[model samples]
Target: MAASTCVRAGEISPGHDSFTGSPSTADRLTGSVAVDGQRRHGGSSRDVRRGRPTLVCPCLPVVDGLSSGRLDQDEGVSSFRKGDHGEPDSVRFEAAGLRWLGEAPGGVAVAEVLSEGPGWLETARVHPGGATAAAAEQLGRALARTHAAGAPHLGCPPAGWTGDGFMGRAQLPLRGTPGPDSWGEFYAADRVLPYLAGAVANGAIDTAGERTVRRCADRLATGELDAPQPRLVTRPAARLHGDLWSGNVLWGERDGIVAATLIDPAAHGGHAESDLAQLGVFGAPHLDRVVAAYDEISPLAPGWRERVGLHQLHMLIVHAALFGGSYGRQTVRTAARYA
Candidate 1:
């Protein structure tokens, strides 16, 4: 009855461990999916047998005993996710993000939000499947369309959402006042600086590393590292899955066909390359196909590959702030390049 064990299809009852399968290579690489009774949740150790409520799947965690499972009503299976304690707006924020992202015509697939309340959100369960080149390619093109949907401004939150959101339990600062025009300024101010400060405050970063990151941030704020606006977009800001790591890109079957479904987004308005760069942070499967197909739809600005490290700095600092281990060192190493 451990939460890490996969629930049997159409069953929500406790104390059943019917699923005995092993996680795939990609799942193992991401450390997000597991069939055994122990696994990591967002890089943090989680053991449901020790007083936490049993989760229906390893990817989704719930609080206050609000576990996800089959409804047994013939409407098919659904996954429930509840907000962590003290984060009241988390579930609502996620619901708004999913709705906004799903609005794009021909965009990447997102989990359908079935219902939501003050502390919990429910979504249709996407059955797990193997990743293929074709699926990755289609995801790439669809992702381009999603980014083309655009946002009102860089660093803006999803439409209809107010206040700040989260990026995997870390406070994700959203746009409150607008002044910076270019993506570089917005990214430096909203994306990198906030998490950098948090990492420092947590003692995850040393004085030397802090100084190095600040230098990088200064250059970024001066608009020195900004890339040209992507073709076919009027706005500078793209609708980004703010936390687009491989763990968030769920490869699964929908409508009897294999495809990618995006989940657990810290969705916002930002540079498109930021999303693309995150795919590389943890080695997304068939990433080359994803990017190539995306370029076919909306050609990326030149020199994008060269700027991957620049774009990836934010997520690294976030990891530093939250996990406080080698992530701090990694953040400094990446920032040293731009510094």
Candidate 2:
């Protein structure tokens, strides 16, 4: 799971197709779809198979065997995907997370889940044409609302998602302390320190780099970095799109309105600012507008901007552990800033 990267749902093109006993020209029109059977549904490829035209859907590349694309039906073109793991529990966890986030106040706009079963999830397709400043601003505002929705504690998974969550393809353990003194502590213990250890064991981070990270991690644990009032925004655990990089923010227009729709969430309860900081990880377009809008709705704490790199350390280290390259160096640099 570490090697897998999450896809940005907005950039994908959508179409729809269904599998039923046979190969049809309609099936060919829907690229990237796979079906178990070979028999055609209506007629042979040569026949028009009159009455209704078969819908061809587009599929997105997900980690392992999970495939996402569009499905055609009278209701509308729905976003659909099939999971690699044939377990209902796996699909249920993600589906539950998406639903929880979508239902939150100023909630996120997510692809609607139509139906899900073992090894498969079907959803309403989102066609993101491009990112716009207006959309970015709206995203920021809504994100604040999402965070304000709150959680039981930091590191907690979305309601109903009891199983371990994921970051990309890597399994991420989701557990929270009864009540923590500071966000830094939980982040260090659950997010940073564990990944650092794994990176060191895999030779991704050399001994010296590992030592440096440990120092920063120790500081995190001691709560030295914790500045409760000014530096951090104290709030109930806010709902977080655990992975909020730009790619996950899908941009699209509907009814002449453009907006950012979130996809591929690693949703959880955590500091709202952490989700905001993640936007800068890979550089989100119109980030300034997004931040400004968010701040207007839910004012951020003083010096929150400076903490961007601090929050980003978790993802950097995760990348280092998984990709094993210059990412390790980048992680250390970010950690050193706060250390």
Candidate 3:
């Protein structure tokens, strides 16, 4: 169904109460694209037509054919507003319960050929620096606000996720029910351990790193790793930009942390700490305050900081798989931090 919708790329409004009671008018979804055609609410059909306008994304051409309107809209809906990681997985907006709430799928990509200046990765340039560090905190806090909005209605429902990461190709985890009963088992077996093996097979990884990952997996699997229980959560689950890193953090207007709008997301119902850990690894701006603010609203475990290094290993491995240069070095260093 979603694959068909992605091909169509038709204007849609979820009929569900996704945005029904939100105070923001933007969150109030009144109608959807009619099965027959475009539907108008109180305003004239002409009014609807008048208000509707086309959006132009610089990277559309490469994406349109790629998505073919066949991507998972349900999963896309889950990723609407997140602390964007640096991928062009931004998608069509869906409804939510917070500031200018909406959902987005990676499938909205459309195609046209052009030797564009820069690219969808403009956010990467906004690295946290002297002044930007303060902004990074603000950005982190704003991300917490986004968290306060409410959880996503849709979920990935897929077990495997492998769009891109460290070396060139690697599979990560997504949200949904797994056959495994515990989040710990699911995370270690399905998430980190798989990538450990994949990285080795791809030649981007080595024996030492592989052994460490396996060891970490063993400890985590056998209850050797110290992890906090009664994890941070939100209804419908946590709204993570999933793949947050330093490059993904953006500077919004001169200074002050603006938005942690997410890009490439392995989005799902999982730990909010995972997102924070990635933010920290890349030296993302405003590291200290981000966690403090988040704790004010959604407190993390007492020892969340200690566990962050463990979580950082996962993302470092991802980067090693994607970039394969210094990132691989970083991956080895970070993984060894535990071993």
For all candidates in order, the CA lDDT equals 0.69, 0.63, 0.40
RMSD of each: 10.0, 12.0, 17.8
Give the lDDT of residue 66 in candidate 3. Answer: 19
Residue-level lDDT of model 3, residues 157-271, one tens digit each, is: 3123323222113444443433443445555765576656546656666887677666667766665554443233444444555556544433433254333433334455445
TM-score of 3: 0.53
Best-performing candidate as measured by lDDT? 1
State the displacement of the C-alpha of residue 178, model 1, in Å, after optimal TM-score superposition: 3.3
By TM-score rank, best first, the candidates go 1, 2, 3
The estimated TM-scores of all candidates read 0.81, 0.78, 0.53
Candidate 1 C-alpha lDDT tens digits along 1-339: 223434322122133211111112122223433343222233211221111222344434443333333322134444444444456577678788888899988899998887777766667656677788899899989999899998888878888998899876677889855558888788888888888877888887999999999999999988989887566455757888888877677777778888998876889888898888777665567777888899888998987766877887888888788667666777787788788
What is candidate 1's local distance difference test score? 0.69
Q: Provide the lowest-lDDT 10-residue window in model 1.
A: 17-26
Model 1 pairs whose backbones collide? none
Give candidate 3's error at residue 228 in angstroms: 4.0
> Which digits, one per residue and each the tens of the lDDT, describe model 2 over residues 1-339?
011222222111112111111112122212311232111111111111111234564654444545544456676553445454633455566677789889886666876778887766676655545677788788878888877777777878888777578775556668744556577788888789878876777777888888789888888888876643222234557778887765566676677888877766788887786777676555567777887788887887776756766777776777677666656776776677677
Model 2: lowest-lDDT 10 consecutive positions = 37-46
